[model samples]
Target: MTSEDPHRLEAGHLPTPFSADEIRAATPQGRTQVVRTEPLGGAASTRRVRYVEPDAEGVIQVRTSIGEDGEDQDAPVRERVTWRDLQSHASYPADRTSLERARLEHPLGDLDCVRYTMGDGDAVDTVWFDLARPGLPVLLESRRGSDLVLRVTLLSDEVDPG
Candidate 1:
């Protein structure tokens, strides 16, 4: 869906929603090669997945989130951070094995997502990874107060090979 799509949000609204195929198509535009995609189950009021892109070295992890029409009541709150940061701060694992272990230890029921509530349940955030498409960056959306925040995390392996 081009940037002109009506479903595309402006300002604080959020980007337009794209299907798995659409996301895959856009991967090439990012200049990186897309390898594969895998869906991560366990989500409440939304769908989530992890996009895996492998380059010369390792695979890049991309997380994604899609809101449920009726389920999302509040506005969106967006934020971005590295896997290392998520691991250090939010108890998210930097690696897939650790993440899977955490999932088994603290399952989110049938949903493959985790909900983090802040400030007396008035603010809530849910996180999931989309491994469905390579080259596609990780997608994150947060809802707080009357605004919805959306974030896309791209892997800069080529530019920042560390």
Candidate 2:
């Protein structure tokens, strides 16, 4: 998080918010079961991550709308979230290394907290791990330029016990 404390990548390092187990462990504790994945994408697709979960299958690729203004207003960006079958890390690309940016204050709603970014490009994955919360993606936001197209805030969550 801090410059002094740099991110170290080692074997078996998963850059994702949390592993499948972590998400399952932090499932809703009691009768409350309102927590769930935000309905960003509703249609079925093999290339996009329509919804995300611990055992949900496949890695999610955040889609960014890329185009120039006044180019074509009729063809507005139509994005959807979908998932693919989970592939072994050995087969996964190694380019997804962590690219830590900074440790600064991230204000979600009214509460201001310290958070950091990982991965490269205009929008990196942000997590408030230090904020002391459970489950994967305490807050995972995907943005296109300054406009926030999608945001996953953990309000309440759980996996159906089988």
Candidate 3:
């Protein structure tokens, strides 16, 4: 957010103002996302499907792995105020000074994203949230030095916006 920030341009942009309606419009009920994950050291990437739905209280997300060595594994069901809340890192730095804006290209399409980078010891994790989709994460990556440790990309959304 500052001029000296390494991730931002010399001329910084204003922070995005978000509303509940914008978040709701971006996320629909019964939507599913296809996610791909690549781990460190060239390990085989894995595919996962995440189902999203809205309940009277909030949004629910259930994730299950695709083909792998063994049977499919289901991740614990998550409930959140919004679908994007499920992917949020509560412990991450919350200061606007740590935020950056970037154009991210994913299987879904080219998108404008709000980026946040955090470092812990030797590892650095970067998360990109789609600007058009409120809190939806388009990509997440972790690296040590220059070697990628993990990467997760939202490949597609099954729900049609219409």
lDDT of 1: 0.32
lDDT of 1 by residue, 1-162 (tens): 235553333333332223323433433312332122222332233323232443322334433334444233444333333322222233322222122211211221322333222332444344443333222324333456655543323322122222
Q: On residues 43-97, what C-alpha lDDT tens digit does candidate 3 reach at each position?
A: 5555543446654435666566655663466564564555224322322444433
Q: What's the distance in Å from true for residue 128, model 1?
A: 1.5
Over all chains combined, what TM-score does candidate 2 have?
0.34
lDDT value, residue 159 of candidate 1: 24
Candidate 2 structure quality by residue, lDDT tens digits, 42-75: 4211111112233343322222222233122233
TM-score of each: 0.24, 0.34, 0.65
Alpha carbon RMSD to native, model 1: 16.8
Number of the top TM-score candidate: 3
lDDT of all predictions:
0.32, 0.34, 0.60
Q: Score candidate 2 by lDDT.
A: 0.34
